[model samples]
Target: MHSRAVFMLLAAFALGACRGPKSDCEGSYESWTGSMAAHDWDSAYELLTPEFKKKVGSPKRMAAYMEDSWKGSKSFEFSPFDIAETNAGVCTARGEMRYTVKIRGELPKDHEQVYFSYVFRQEKDGLWYIELPGNERIQSF
Candidate 1:
């Protein structure tokens, strides 16, 4: 009986380890930003919540915007900091991005720095997704 109880305890511990920690929300955000910096729009878009997709119009439109905005950029960097949870299933991530753009033939090159705050929602699937700025109540902040 004692050996059986020990086995059960070990099983429980293993199961808990398999479930991982609750910090996946931060991991998701990091993955999303990494995708964006790599110019992998499809992967980045996949990280956005359904509601955000609707507000942004469409996946194609989102990709177009990314392409246009980053056009002619030599390098892009996004540093996410101050990630905190605001409520259940809701978290906010603030960051700054810097990129350099090379202009052709006459126009001077431009270097841009932008500060951003984004909301992320933890869905029923236990994954976090970006909540974009929109008419949605999630954007009230």
Candidate 2:
């Protein structure tokens, strides 16, 4: 009887561990965006789904691209947020993101604005990853 009780308790703990962190889809996206603002490449990569990292192939490559994209700007920021969920519980999010960068030999800072959307799904592991709505491309900063 004690052994059976122990098994049940372990099972309960396992189930609880499977539950993902308490974060809405938009919140997750914003967390990633915040990482970008701080130029925290590692933190930004951590926010990506494993699938996304696979698609990008390398953290160094993604970080280089992000740096290139923002080279030459000031007061860069992104704002406005929207999130929607499908009947199947999949989520779609849209927002305006901004950035400021200064490139080599540039006299003035450049600001960039992007209107973007992301589709997300809960993996069997109960974690959410960013997936495209239609295309398989995992878009990220």
Candidate 3:
């Protein structure tokens, strides 16, 4: 109940504090995180940029990777984010992400806050999508 309240407040703050492209980025990002938190890999995969999907190969592979990657994850919420648009269609958001991770046979770790900087690209369709690093090895993306 407490976590849900916090999530609601964060969602309100994230959705309420913007206009224009940044708003779109925030919305897309919120959707992405929400899907991931719900373990809706199919929806999350659909939000990734085509380029990212190509790099990751099929949705099945992406799901497999995310399944392993998110094994200990509980919930996640974004802090205030700032977007910088360098190129016409590219932008980057810098902020903190708070989440929980539970290790097997251990007490759940809660409210782990970490700084995050992520790239976003607005496709020709005028929708923002996640863009991972060019190198596939980086976990940050």
Could you say which candidate leads in TM-score? 3
By TM-score rank, best first, the candidates go 3, 1, 2
lDDT of 2 by residue, 103-133 (tens): 6776564545678776766566665556533
Candidate 1 per-residue C-alpha lDDT over 55-141 given as tens digits, one digit per residue, 9 for 90 to 100 = 677768888988897777757677777888788888888888787776687564656568878777887888888765443254444
Question: Candidate 1: which pairs clash?
Answer: none
TM-score (C-alpha) between model 1 and the true structure: 0.68
lDDT of 3 by residue, 4-107 (tens): 99999998656433211223776776766676666667666777787788878887987888889888887777775686675666666788878888998999
Per-residue lDDT of 123 in model 3: 81
Ranking by lDDT: 1, 3, 2
Candidate 3 pairs with clashing backbones: none
Q: Using Cα atoms with residue i matched to residue i, what is each candidate's TM-score against the true structure?
A: 0.68, 0.62, 0.70
What is the alpha-carbon lDDT of model 3 when measured against the actual structure?
A: 0.69
Looking at model 1, report the run of 10 residues with the lowest lDDT sum: 14-23
